[model samples]
Target chain A: MSKDSNIQIQINHKPTHLPYSMTLAQWVEHQTLELPVALILNNQFIPKGEWAQHLLTDGDHIDLLSPIQGG
Target chain B: MGPSAPDSWNLYDTPMTSRLWMGSSHFPNWNVFASACELAKPGFITLSLRRQTATGGQSYWKLIRSLDIPILPNTAGCFSAHEAIQLAEISRDTFETDWIKVEVIADEQSLHPEGPELIRACEVLIQKGFKVLPYCSDDLSICKALTDVGCRALMPLGAPIGTGLGLLNPFNLERLRYRFPKIPLILDAGLGKPSQATQVMEMGFDAVLLNTAISQSVNPAEMALAFLEAVSAGHRAFKAVPMPAQPNAQPSTPSMDMPIGDYRVGAELYGN
Candidate 1:
């Protein structure tokens, strides 16, 4: 394992720090996402198939979205 | 009515008896929301997407899916065509349905639909095989353009969103209805009371989408029932074909049955 280093990532536009070189799957586990959700990485969609291997780094704008009530 | 009533209308390819489409937001709690959903018995329910909250889980989504009712996902917060299209695609993936309520609001003050952006987004969505229902203003030309672009249904706001101002321009709504009788016109937003919903349905709108009116009421469940009844009654009135106007008064009685049949007052005095 590599030395733990802080990397900033924006989740739903809220800046947060995670261990550097964290995979998207690890981030999902870190965020405790048990339900179905979609992810956008740097203004682009990151499919679920790629989340397990995709790595996140500093300044990545991530938006975790799920269905909410609306009119 | 068991799903399909005598007046069963079709949206895209689905047949629906109820004309009330409820928005699944703003209820006091989940219990109240469940009760209201049960009472309203809408043909479909609308939902949107947002970032997950700590306390907010996916329970509402599970509950909504469990109801076995049709779902209409919306792009409620999108500001431009790009944002609207992206959210809409994500919604389709999450909801597993192609039905979308395309909303492109340029600002928050009025929450009015950005006509061009909305139309552009709808065009792209329609191309992607989505059943697009665009929430738009009561503009005949814009409505025409939306239909021209092949949206499944057209949802025109009765007034501004959530103000409950009630149909600000019935003239325009009526014109939209008159102009596009074949198009499924679902009156959406700005309806505060059951009567307001009834007015739109009575005006020959195919349906209505209600949110704050029911969810924000003193009793959401009760208000839902009221809206259901009002929508049904209004549809019935429309089907009954109300009477037309008359230019002059007409006697309802038989003219020959009058008591003064032979009584000509001035004729008798001048007979000599």
Candidate 2:
């Protein structure tokens, strides 16, 4: 945990243990995440290409929503 | 088992096993989509190509193609006839299939069919040699207009999109079936529960078109299967014609067949 790199991720509305300094891909790989899952940071849709370049700072929100049934 | 359904539905003139049609919008993940599709058991799945996302192959295409069901692309999220017509052209060109679910909405609330716009779109598509299934209202006049333009089928909405009020107007739907016994009339949209799907099928709708009613359930896959069974049961029940309703109550167990009916008790003692 570097002085400026400790990032906080809120997963499913609860605090998660993730490195604030990690990239999106690193964070996902750390959690073994998958696509087809809606990935949002600050509530903006993150296309697949931007995962590596998206460096996390402190107190960033990461939300994943999977497909559900509807008519 | 083969390309054709071998029964009443002519839409099954192809090799798709699932009868349910799934949507490509509002889904959280494309990965779970396969499982959902498997759960949905659609005979043919629906796809669409937006001007922005249709440039190359989409990441979801490979997964959709892998499912082995015929892809019936749509012109959804389109407003006017021109845009829908263009989307149909692009979707057909890219997917190499012209089976389209045409949806053109004019109102936000009720999302009622703008009959004129739908007719215009259907006319154009019919001329272009496409198998068009227009999502229209249950109104016979609007359906007649669409049918006159050589549309193979009409999908009348049971209720507003995702309101799930199954078969809100059964009279119009039954009339539509009676009028066009040969033509396909599927109940599209507004079916939230499995029983609704069954009711539509029981009412003689050839098929159903929906998305939210199944996909947004707490257990989407299970709900999809439930709809599948419900649809099948509805279809079979329609064909079976269980029994006729009457003005008088009919006993399920006949008195003659009852073993304990020999003795007659006093009215006061029996509290008859």
TM-score, every prediction: 0.85, 0.71
Candidate 2 TM-score, true structure as reference: 0.71
Candidate 1 local lDDT, B1-272, one digit each (tens): 44335678888988878889899888899789888888888888998877775225578877887777798989988999999998888887766788999999977899998989999999999999999999999999899999989986899999999888999999999999899988899999999999988888888998999999998999999999999999988888787778887999877886774656355754686783
Query: Residue A48's C-alpha lDDT in candidate 1?
Result: 70
Alpha-carbon runs more than 4 Å astray in model 2: A1-71, B1-8, B12-17, B53-57, B257-272
> Which candidate gets the maximum TM-score versus the true structure?
1
lDDT of 2 at B2: 39
Local accuracy of candidate 1 as per-residue lDDT tens digits, A1-71: 45456788888778888865678877887877545777788878877778887788888888788878899
Tens digits of per-residue lDDT, candidate 2, A1-71, equal 34443456676566765534677767667764332343567765565567888877667776654322222
In lDDT terms, how accurate is model 2? Answer: 0.71
Task: Score candidate 1 by TM-score against the native.
Answer: 0.85
Clashes of each: 0, 21
